[model samples]
Target: MSQTVNALEVKASPASNQTGYRSFELGSFAFSRDEYFAKVTWHVGGQKLSHVMSADAFLRAMMRDVAWGFFYGWVNFDPVIGTRNLYGKVELYAGAYHPAYKEKGLDLTETFDSREIMATFKAILDDWTNEGFDPFAAPDETDTTWVGKKNGNNRLAIERQRQACKRMPGLAGDAELRTDKNGYPVNRAFADVSQEEPEVHAEPGFEDEVHAFSLFAYLSRSDVTWNPSVSSVLERSLCCPTTEEYILPIKHGNDRVEWFIQLSDQIEWEIEDKQTGAPRAKVIMKAGDVAAMPADIRHQGYSKKRSMLLVWENATPGLPELYESGKLKPNPVEF
Candidate 1:
């Protein structure tokens, strides 16, 4: 795992097309934005290839990429454009995994120091995101204000820290419980959800140790959708519950099996082979339904309404190596 650390820098320059807007260069990929679209261009062989995404979509995906430290593995911004985290480094690519580009040998991929790409992405998001538009929020909750010249910056929304708890919310010295005073007012879609905290009857020495809080009440106050927050942790296991609406921004390629428990409402998942992107199956999960996203496949979820999903993960070190080496099966169970 030895690697060299390069000097961190923002690889962006002022774009000629828009005032206050910047175009970025990261390795072989170039990112530029206009009023309505964010374009990523790269060269393959002798031709220039470009892929476009709505400014909002591009910003949202970039927000996650910056927030998650590039995430576990592949973070497909769309079917054609995204980044693959190599931990200390990142692979910025266009059409690297898409069938059309792969078959024709037109795909492009370039690796960069993780810090270098992250800084450039952060600069791009800050310059492109306008005021009143939150890239981290659900589409309906935000507006179409990204389709114009930069009006102002929404640093508060874009820079908010992802929730992570040492034990659980409400515990002493741990994360604070979400409250209206803390700017986490209950979301409109979850108005009917109960806001009661659980009462725990603890004996003698267990007063500080025993605790409980209403998970649904906490989730009802979530400001962002499709962003999983760590709610509970025990050694290598983590319980990450998130609210979901619309489509998941990225197609997550798992290095290990990820279990999902549908806490409320419903979601439909489209599964594909991890390497080929070939269709695997469509799974529709309702409240109380549970499913496992296998390590061998990539999957994306679609939610018609804001729904709660609990993602159970095994964070044991070297698990991916075990899976890749054939020492472990891609699935949780053979059946």
Candidate 2:
């Protein structure tokens, strides 16, 4: 039996504000609707980029950004809740979809089509400009404060689990650390790659803090099962209420591999490396944005005026168990 998939259908119309933006179809089914969304940011080198994508386009772009190294973020409207939103999630593969992959690497043809991806992206932009929605006017902060604290609790539990797992024998391996062209520590862990490059920092007084949690889950693509676990230990970690701050230090051979799952409305920040004295990069994240930082990279947290996030992690086997032991570091930073 053949399985049915949704088709790409789009309709573009001039926006009511006369700003030259257009409205587009939001979803393939009747219950779905398009909402206003925007992603704008400036990199450390001073390059500006922006994109207006629907929720779906925002996801795909984020996937691409993690696969290829680039500044990709977004701000979106949630019609169901009547609010503007912000979010960020890390992509594990920094070069997941490189040109080299087209001929010599993972075959994405069966899983993703360029045309469909573009259609989704266009629809998001069109809906924002023409749908009479605002991406900045979120609800009052007081109404959403409780949800934020709840998410913080969830984040903390996941990190404690990872800290415990680090102690098991055979859980630690050479693969945990990212190596350079000559095979040296690339900023302690693979997650820190973005921090070493001068082009990925944030604003002044904003230092980057690592998300101690790691995120690893399965997204069923049309062709294959994308599993990050085969390569690294930290599989899927969530960033909800339990986590506050994470630190990814310069590699000295004793760092752990950590990742973060940035759920809806939570903000992950970026900034310059304090030790290196590099200039900061500009970050503009909207609702539905996902980005990843290497272990050495620094990032912080930005909560929505009202909302919750689910962060996931996949850590080296014995690390989680170690946190339960007395050896775990005290008062780890929160994001």
Candidate 3:
């Protein structure tokens, strides 16, 4: 069934209860925020259901959702409340596939145009985020002052674009080199990581075409965890290398096979069936280990120590439809 609809189903209301933070209604779900928490309220079968998240966490997750264009599949804000991307459409759900909520049949889901929720989410983030707090920064790197009313805006912090290069960093026509003035300093934990850049020897005419950058060195300065930055793009294939620490904020349900090349440290992944949330397997990947997350399942990562990961994805349009139609296998290898 097509989830796409012609008209927007979301409605924006004035500041909720004089807090000056606007409340939003997307179909049946109502979103409101106070000083410290973001609340979602809805009615299901005569029962009023509610879900809440820390304002910081809500803003963090929503920032990614808005930035990634809603991402490929499920972007679970918590285990209970989140969204699923249907490309042009989105599914806003509370407890839809979560085992505890699903078992009790209390799950509620509403589909909306991708633009509808995207706009509402962006507004919510803008209103709730304060001047001093940065939702994108790691907990230790940023302040814990997300409480109280909005004072000023952090557009520079929240709106920072993930690095995406046409060819390579430092190349004349490609992405620029990250510098100290650029605010991408080496993370404290990654102090031992080298700051060396790769030297490329190319044919006389291929100086611009042949280039290289140290992926480890580039990733050592990352300020955010579990967020992938596109280091290189070749057609539909993307090499997204990211720094990882702590738990992945969301359980990502893939619409296509995602390959992981563990570059440093270790990450233990909790894999579950995409539709049912049933246990599938536990994968512990150490340095130099590689794994493939099938499109048919959802997975979340746990990194005890700071680590580096290379996430390779195929961003070809309409790939999800091919997987759903059985025209393409969800797993990269059948055997």
**Residue-pair clashes per candidate:** 0, 82, 0
Candidate 1 TM-score versus the reference = 0.94
TM-scores for candidates 1 onward, in order: 0.94, 0.21, 0.89
- Cα lDDT of candidate 2 equals 0.27
Candidate 1 lDDT at 15 equals: 54
lDDT of each: 0.86, 0.27, 0.83
> RMSD to native for every prediction?
3.4, 22.1, 4.1
How does residue 324 of candidate 1 score in lDDT? 84
Candidate closest to the true structure, highest TM-score: 1
Model 1, span 1-335: residue lDDT tens? 11222455666675555456777777778888888899999888889999999888889888988888887778888889888887788988888889999999999989988888877777778778999999888888897889788788898888888898988888998888899998999998999999988889999999889999999999999999878888998987999899999988888888788899999999999999877789999999999999999888888999989999998888787887888888999988975
User: Which segments of candidate 2 are over 4 A away from where they belong?
Assistant: 1-257, 266-268, 277-284, 304-306, 317-335
Which candidate order results from sorting by lDDT in descending order?
A: 1, 3, 2
lDDT tens digits by residue: candidate 2, 86-120 = 11221121112233422344312112233443444
Off by over 4 Å in 3: 1-13, 16-20, 99-105, 148-151
Cα lDDT tens digits, model 3, 195-249, are 9887789999997788788778889988778778888788889998888887776
Cand. 1 Cα-lDDT: 0.86
Ten contiguous residues minimizing lDDT sum, candidate 1: 1-10
